[model samples]
Target chain A: MQFWIVQSLNSLALGGLLFLLATGFSLIFGLMRIANLTHGALFMLGAYVGVTTLKFVPNLWLAALIAGLLVALFGGLLERSILRRLAGNALGQVLVTLGVSFIVADFCLIVWGGDPIPIAAPTSLQRPIVVGNIAFPAYRLVVLGIAIITAIALHLLMERTRLGAMIRAGVDDMQMARAVGVPVSRLFTTVFCLGAALAGAGGVIAGPIMSAYPGLDADMLPLALIVVILGGVGSLLGAFVGSFVIAIIYTFGSALLPDLAYVILFLPMIVVIAFRPRGLFGRRST
Target chain B: MSAAARIVLVLVLVAFPLIGGDFYINLASQIFIAALFATSLNLLVGYGGLVSLGHAAWIGLAAYTSAWLYLHLGLRHWITAPLALVNTTLIAGLFGWIALRATGLGFLMITLALSQVLWGTAYRWAAVTNGDNGLSGLTRPAPFGISLDGPAAFYYFSLTVTIVAVWMMARLVNSPFGAALRGSRDESRRMSALGHNVWLVRWLTFVYSGFWGAVAGLLFVYYHKYIHPTALSLTSSAEVLLGVIAGGAGTIAGPIVGAAIVLILKNYVSAYLDRWNMLLGAVFVVIVIFMPDGIVPGIRRWSARLRKT
Candidate 1:
C-alpha cells in the first residue's frame, strides 16, 4: 500500500513536470513547424541556472523565476538569431536546434562539471506532511500544486487574453491569421519564449526530485517527445492526459516489470502510431 | 561527375589503406562503415524523403543480436550475422509500419520514440545487455578461410562490403522504383493517384535501409569487437543524418565525401579537443545555414555559376 501510494504520487509529480515541458514543446511545434530539440537542453540549462541562483537567493520560487526569465531570454535570442533565418526550411531549423542543444549541453557540462547537483526545497516545504497512514513529501505535493496552478494560469491566459486569441487564430491558420493582421511573426517569438520559460521554471521545480545532472537533457527529452507525440501537438488537454499516462506507465512499469518497462511503454505508443497516426487528440487537418 | 573522375576516386579509396600508413588502415575501415551507413540512410531520406530519426536503433539492434548470439549461445559469425540481419530487418518492418503512418513531423517523432524504446531496453535490461558496461571482447569472422583479424584484412573486408552495398544502392536508385519513390516524396497524393503504392514503396525502402544499417552494425562490432547502448543513441542517428545532409543527400558522391569528412573530423579532432561536441554542434549550425544543399551539390552549383560568369 505504501509503495503504491509513493509510486502514484511520484507519477503525478512527474506528470506535472512533463506538462510544463510538453505544453511549450507542443505549442512551439504547432506555431512553428520546427521541432525545438533545444528545449531539452533548455531544461538542463534552466536547472543549472536555477542551481546557481539558489546559491545567491536561497528562495526556490525566486530562483525558479530568475531561471525561467534567463532561459526565456536565451530562447528568444535563438529564435531571432538562428531559427528566424531558416523560416520555411523546417528540416534546416530543426538541425540548427540540434546544434544549439549540443552547444548548451556542453556548456552546462563545462560550467557545472559532471557531478549531479542536489537542490533543496525551501525550508517551509522541506519536511514531509503526515496523513492517516502515510507521510507525503511536502515538496512533491508542492510540485503538484504548482502544476495545477500553472495549468489554471495558462488556461486563463489563453482563454481570457487578446494575445491568447491571436495565438489561437495563428495556430488554427497562419495565413488567415496574417491576413487579419495578427502579427504572427512576433507572436512566434512570444510563443517560443513562453515555452522556454515554462520548461525553464519546470526544471527548477524538478531539481529537488531529479537533481541537476549531466545527461538530464537526454533523460528528459524522450519523455517530452513521448508526451508531445502521444498528446497531439498544440492540444493542452492532450498534453495533460498524455503526461499522466506516460508518467504512470514509466513509474509503475519501472517498479513492477523493470526489464519489460520499455516494452510496456513503447508497445502502446507503437500501436497508437500504427493505428491512429494523428495521436489520440490530434487535429484532423495537418 | 565524369566517369574518369569516378574511377579515379574509387581507385584512390580502394588503395587508401595501402599507402595511408598501417595506423590509419583502421581509421579507413571505420570511415567505410560510416559511409555505407550514410548511404543506406540516404536511400530513405534523400530518395524517399522519409527522414527517420530512430534508424540508429536498427544498427544497435543487429549488433546486439549478433553479439548476444555469439557470446551466450556460442554461435559462429556466419550463422549469427545472417540471423542478426534478418532479425533487424523484420523488426524494422514493424517499426516502419507504425512510423510511416504519419507524414513529416509525426513520422519523425514516432521513429525517434520507438528508437528510445530500444535504447531504453538495452540500457535497463542488465541481465542481457550488461547495461552501461556493454558486451565486449567479440571475435571477427574468417570468410573463405581468410581471417579478418588484422587491420589490413578488416579494411579489405569493409571495403568489399561497402563496394557491393553502394553498387546495389546505385542499381536500385536507377530503377523505375526509384522514380516512383521520388514522385511519392514530392507529391504523395499525386503519386498515389498515379497508382504508385506510396506506402509499400516507403515500407520496402525502410526495410532495405534497415538491412544495410544492420550490415554497418555488423562491421561496427567486428571493428571494435564490442557493442554498447550508445550505438543506439540519438547522437548516433544525428551523426548519420548530418553526414547525409553535409555530403549531399540525393547524390551518390555526397554521402561518401560527407561520411569521410564527418568521421575524420570526429575521430581526429576529438583526439585533440575536449570541446569537440560543441564544435560538432557548430558545424551542424553552420552547415544548415550556409550549405543546406550539402557540400557536393553546393560545390557543383558554385562551379556551374562560376563557369557561367
Candidate 2:
C-alpha cells in the first residue's frame, strides 16, 4: 500500500509536468492544425535558460518565469516569421518546424556543450514531507500544486474568456472566425506563444527532477505528443486525463514489468487508439 | 525528359563504377542504396498520399533481421535478405491495418508511435541486440555466386539491384493499380464510390513500400558491415523524407536525385564544415520555402518557361 501510494504520487508529479507540455501542444495543434515540432525545442530552451537564470536570479520561481517568457517570445517570433508563411500546407508545416528544431537543437548543443545539468530546487521546497511512515519530496508536492493551478487557470481562460471564445470559433472554422472580425493571425501568434510558455514552464518544473540535457527535446517531445494524442488532439480535459494515464503507465510499468515496460507503456495507447481514433476527448471532425 | 537523355543518365551511372576507382565506387553504392530507400518512401508519399514519418523502422527491422539471422542462425545473406523483406512486409501490413483505420494526422502519429516502440525495444532489449554497442564486422554474402566483397563488386551488385528495383517501381507507378492508388489519394470518396477498396490500396502500398525499405536495410548492412539502433531513429526517417522532398515526390528520378544530393552533402560537404547540421537545415528550409515543388519539378517549370520565352 505504501509503495503504491509513493508510486502514485510520483506519477502525479510526472503527470503534472506532462500536462503543462501537452496542453500547449494540444492547443496549438487544435487551433492551427500545425504539429509545431519546435515546441519540444522550446521546452529544452526553457530548461537551459532556467539553469542559466538560476546563476543570476537566485530565485527558482523568478528564474523559471523569466525563462518561460523568453521561450514564449521566441515562439512568437517563430510564428511571425515561419509558421505564418506556411498556412494550410501540412507537409510544409511539418518540415519547416522539423528544420527549425534541428537548427535549434544544434544551437543548444553548441551553447551547452552536451552535458546534463539540473537546476537547483528552491531551499524551502528541498525538504521531504512526511506522512506516518511515508516521506515524499516537498518539491514534488510543489510541482503538483503548480500543475493543478496552471491547469485550472488554463481551463478558466479557455472556458470563460473572450479570447477563448475567439480561439474556439477559429478552431471550428477559420474562415467564419475571420468573417466575424476576429484577428485570427494575431490570435494564432498569441496562442502559440502561450503554448510555448507553458511548455517552457513544464521544462523548468521538470528540470530539477529530470535534469536539463541536450537530448531532452527529443525525449520529451514524443512523450508530450503521446499525451496529446492519448488525451485527444485538441481537448484540454483529454490532455489532463491522458497525462495522468501515461505518467502512471510509465512509472508503474517500469516498476512492475521492468523488461517489457515500453511495450506495456504503449499498450494503453494502442488500445485507446484502436477504440477512439479521434482520441478520448477529440472531436470527430478534427 | 527524352528517352535518349534517360538512357544517357543510366549509362553514366552504370559506367562510372568501372572508371571512378574505389572511393567514388563506394560513394556511388551508398547513393544507390539511399536512392532505393527514398524511392520506396516516395511510392507512399507521392502516389499513396501517405507521408509516413517512421519509414526508417522498416529499414531498421530488416537490417536487424539480416544481421541477427547471419550472426545467430548462420544463414547466408541470400536467404536472410528474402526473410528480412518478408518480415518487414508482414509487420508493415499489421501496422498499416491499425494505422489506416484513422486518417491524416492520426495515421502519421500511429506510424511514429509504432516506430518508437521498435526503437525502445532495440534500445532496451540488450541480450539479443547488444543495446547501444551495436552489431558490427559483418561480411557481404556471395549470393548467386557473385563476389560482393570488394568495393567494385559490391557497387555493381547494388547498382544492378537498385536499377531493377527502380524499374519495378517505375512500372508500378504507371500501372492500373498505381492509377487507383493515386485516384484514392486525390479523390477518396469518388474512388470508394467507384467500388475501389481505398483502405486496401493504402495497406498494400504500405506493405510494398516496406519491402523496398527493408531491401535498403539489407543492402546497408552488407555495405557497411554493421547495424545500429540509430538506423531505427526519427532522424533516419526525417533524412529519407528530406530526400523525397528535395528530389520531388511522385516521380521516379526525383528521390534518387535527392538521395544523391543529401548523401553527397553528408559525406563530402561535412568534411569541411563543423556546423554541417546548421547548413543542412538552412538548405532544407530554403528548399521548402523556395522550391516547394522540389528540384525536378522546379527545373522542369523553369525550362518550360525558358522554352516559351
Candidate 3:
C-alpha cells in the first residue's frame, strides 16, 4: 500500500510536467495545424533560462515568470522569422522545425558541455510531506498543485475569455475567422508564443526534479508527443488525462515488469490509437 | 531530358564510382542508400498522401532482422535479404492496418507512436537486440558467388539494387493499383463512396513503402557492417522526411536528388564547422521560405518559364 501511494505520487509529478510540455504542443497544433517539432527545444531553453535566472533573482516564482516570458519572446521571433514563411506546407514546417530543434540541441550541448545542471528546489518547498507512513516530496506536491491551477486557469481562459474565443474560432475555421476580421495570422503568432510560454513554465517547474541536460529535450519531446496523442490533438483536458495515465504506466509498469517497462509505456497508446484514433477528447470533424 | 538522356545519366552515375576517388565513391554509395530510403518514403507521402513520421522503423526492423539471422541462424546473404524484406512487409502491413484507419494529422501521430514503440522494444529487448550495445561485426560476404568485401564491389552491388528498386517503383507507380492509390489521395471519401476500399489501398501502399525501406536497410547493413537502435529512432525518421521534402514529394527522382544534397551538405559542413546544425537549420528555413515546392519543382518552374520566353 505504501509503495503504491509513492508510485501514485511520482506519477502525478511526472504527469504534471508532461501536461505542461504537451499543452503548448497541443495549442500550436490546434491553432496552426503545424507540428512544431522545436517545441521540445523551447522547453529545454526554458529550463536552462529558469535555472540561470534563479541565480540572480533568488526567487523561484520570479525566475519561472521571467523564463516563461523570455521563451515566449523567442517563440514569437521564430514564428515571425521562420514559421511564417512555411505556412500551409506541413512537410516544410516539419523540416524547418526539426532543423531548429537540432540547432537548439547542439547549441545547448556547446554551452552546457553535455553535463546535467543541478537546480535547487525552492527553500520553502524542499521538505518532504508526511502522509501516514508514506512521505512524498513537498516540491512534487507543489508541482501537482500548480499544474491543477494552471489547467483550471487555462480552461477558464479558453472557455470564457474573448481572446480564447477568437483562438477557438480560428481553430475551427481559419477562413471563416479571417473573413470575419479575426486576424488569423496574428492569432497564430500569439497562440504559438503562448504555447511556448506554457512549455517554458513546465520546464521551470520540472527543472529541480529532472535537471537541465543536453539530451533531456530528446526524451521530453517524445513523452510530450505521446501525451498529446494519447490525450487527443487540440484537447487541453485530454493532455492532462493522457499525462497522468502515461505517468502511471511508467511508474507502476517499471516496478512490475522492469524489462518490459518501455513496451508497456507504448501499449496504452497503441490501444488508444486502435480504438480512438482521434484521442479520448478530440473533436469529430463533421 | 529525353529517355535516352536519362539512361545516359544513369550510366554516368554507375561509372563515376570507377573514376572517382575512394572518398567520393564511399560518399556516392551512402547517397544512393539514403536515396533508396527517401524514395520509399516518397511512395507514401507523394502517392498515398500518408505522411508517416515513423517510416524509419521499417529500415531498423530490416537491419535487426538481417543482423540477427546472420548471427543466430547462420543464414546466407541471399536467404536473409529476402527474409528481411518479407518480414518488414508483414510488420508494415499489420501496423498499416491499424494506422490507415486514421487520416491526416491523426495518421502521422499514430505512425510516430508506432515508431517509438519499435524503438522502445529495441532498447529493452536486450537479449535479442543487444540493447544499446547494438549488433555489430556483420560483414558483406560472397553471396551465391559474388565477393562483396571490397568497397568497389559493394558499391556496384548497392547501385544495381538501387536501380532495380527504382525501376520497380516506377512501374508500380504507373500501374492501375498506383492510379487507385493516387485517386484515394486526391479524395478518399469519394473513392470509398464509389465502392473502392480506400483503407486497403493505403495499407498496400504502406506495405510497398516498407518493402523499399527494407531494401535500403539491407544496403545500409552491408555498407555499415552494423545496426543499432538509432536506426529506428525518431531522428532517423525525421531525416528521411527532410530528404523527401527537400527533393519534392510526388516527383519520381526527387528523393535521390534530395538525399545527395542532404548527405553532401552534412559531410562538407560538419567537417568545417562545429555548429553544423545551425547551418542545417538555416538551410531548411531558406528552402521552405524560397522553395516551398522543393528543389525539383523550383527547377521545373524556372525551366518552364524560360521555355515560354
Candidate 4:
C-alpha cells in the first residue's frame, strides 16, 4: 500500500509536468494549425537557460521566470520569421519545424557537451515529508501544487478573460474570427509565444527532477506528443486528463511489465484512435 | 531527359562504378540503396498522398529480422532474405490495417507513435536485439554458386536489386491498381462514396511501401553488415522524408535524386562539421521554402518551359 501510494504520487508529479508541456502544444496546434516539432527543443532551451541562470543568480525561481520569458521571445521571433511563411502548408510546416528542432538539438549538444546537469531544488523543499510509515518528496509535492495552481489559473484566464474568449473563437473558426477583425496573424504569434512560455516553464520545473541533458529533448518530445494525442488535440482539459492517465499507465506498466511499457502506452492510443479518431475529448469536425 | 537519354544516363551510372575506383563505387552503392529507401517512401507519400513519418521502422524491422535469422538460424542469405521480407510485409500489413483508418495529420502522428513503440521494444528487448550494441558480423550468401561476400560483388548485387525494384515499382505505378490508388489520393471521399474501399487501398499501399522499405533494409544490412536500433528511429524516418522532399515526392526518379543529394551532403558535411544537423536543418528549410516541389520538379518545369519557348 505504501509503495503504491508513493508510486501514485510520483505518477501525479510526472503527469503534472507532462500536462504543462502538452498544454502549450495543444494550444499552439489549436490556434496556429502548425505542428511545432521544435516545441520540445524550446523546452530543452528553457531548462538550459534556467540552469545557466542559476549559476549567477542563485535563485531558482528567478532563473525559471527568466528562462520562460526568453523562450517566449524566441518563439515569437520563430513565428514571425519562419512559421508565419509556412502557414496552411502542413508538410512544409512539419519539415521546417523538424529542421529547426534538429538544429536546436544539435546546438544544445554542442554547447552542453552531452552531460546531465543537476538543478538545485529549493532548500525548503529538499527533504522528504514523512507521515507514519509513508514518505514523499516535498519538492515533488510543491511541483504538483504549482501545476494545479497553474491549471486553475489557466482555466480562469481562458474562461473569464477577453483574450481567452478571442482564442476560443479563433480556434472554433479562424475564418470567422478573421472576418470579425480578430487580428489572427498577431494572435497566432501571441499564442505561439505563450505556448512556448508554458513549455519553458514545464522544462524549468521538470529540470530538478528529470535533470537537464543533451538527449533529454528527444526523450520528452515523444511523450509530450503522446499526451497531446491521447488527450485530444487542442483541448487543455483533455491534456490534463490524458497526462494523468498516461502517466499512471506508464508508471504502473513499467513496474508490471518492464519490456512492454511502451507497447502498452501505444495500445491505448491505437484503440482510442480506432474508436474515436478525433481523440477522447476531441471535437468532431463539421 | 528523353527515353534514350535516360537509358544512357542509367548506363553511365552503372558504368561509372566500374571505372571510378573503390571510393566512388562504394558511394554510388550507398546512393542506390538509399534511393531504394526513399522510393519506397514515395510509394505512400507521392502515390497514396499519405505522409508517414515512421516508415523507417519497417526498414529497421526487416534489417533486424534478417540479421537475427542469419545469426541464430544459420540460414544463408538467399533463404533468410526472402523470409525476412515476408515477415516484414506481414507486420506492415497488420499495422497498416490499423493506420489506414486515419487520414492527414492523424496518420502521421499515429505512424510516429507506432515507430516509437517499435524503437522502445527494440531497445528494451536485450536478449533478442542485443540492446544498444546491435547485431554485427552478418555475411552475404554463397547461393547458386555465386559468392556475395566481396564489396564489389555486394555492390553489383545491391545495384541489381535496385534496378529490379525500381522496374517493378514503375510497372505497378502504370497499372490499373496504381491508377486507382492515385485516384483515391485525389478524391478519397468520392472514391469511398463510389463504393471503392478507400481504407483497403490505403492499407495495401502502406503494406507495399513497407515491403519495399524492408527490401531496402535487407540491402542496407548487406551493405553495412550490421543492424542497429537507430535504423528504426524517428530520425531515420525523417531522413527518408527529407529524401522524398529533396528529390521530388511525386516523380519516380525524384526519390533517387533526393537520396543522392541527402546522403552525399550528409556524408560530406558530417566528415568536417560537428554541427552537421544545423546545416541539414538549414538545407531542409531552404528546400521547403524555395523548392517545395523539389529539385526534379523544378528542373523539369524549367526544361519544359525552355522547350516550349
What is the C-alpha DockQ of each candidate?
Answer: 0.70, 0.51, 0.47, 0.59
lDDT by residue for model 1 over B55-107, one digit each (tens)? 79878999999999999999999999999999999999988888888777677
Query: What value does the interface RMSD of model 3 take?
Result: 3.0
Over the stretch B237-284, how does candidate 3's per-residue lDDT look in tens digits? 877877787898888888888878988988898788777667766776
Which digits, one per residue and each the tens of the lDDT, describe model 3 over residues A1-286? Answer: 9988988998899898888889889878877887788888988988889888988998877888899999999899988888887778776776678778888888777876778998889998888999788888899988888889999998998999988899888778778988999988888889999999988877788888998998677777877888877787778898899989988998798788866777787778778777887778776520
* DockQ top scorer: 1
- State in Å the error of residue B200, model 1: 1.1
lDDT of 2 by residue, A188-219 (tens): 99999999999887788888888899878877
Q: List the residue pairs that clash in candidate 3.
A: none
Model 2 regions more than 4 Å off? none
Residue-by-residue lDDT tens digits, candidate 4, B240-287:
899998899978989999999999988898888777678878888999
RMSD of each: 1.3, 1.7, 2.3, 1.7
Computed on C-alpha atoms, the DockQ of candidate 2 is 0.51
DockQ, prediction 3: 0.47
Global lDDT of model 3: 0.84
Cα deviation of B223, candidate 4, in Å = 1.2
True contacts kept of each: 0.73, 0.34, 0.44, 0.57
Q: What's each prediction's TM-score?
A: 0.98, 0.96, 0.94, 0.96
Q: What is the C-alpha lDDT of each candidate?
A: 0.89, 0.85, 0.84, 0.85
Error of 1 at B302 (Å): 2.7
Per-model clash counts, in order, read 0, 1, 0, 0
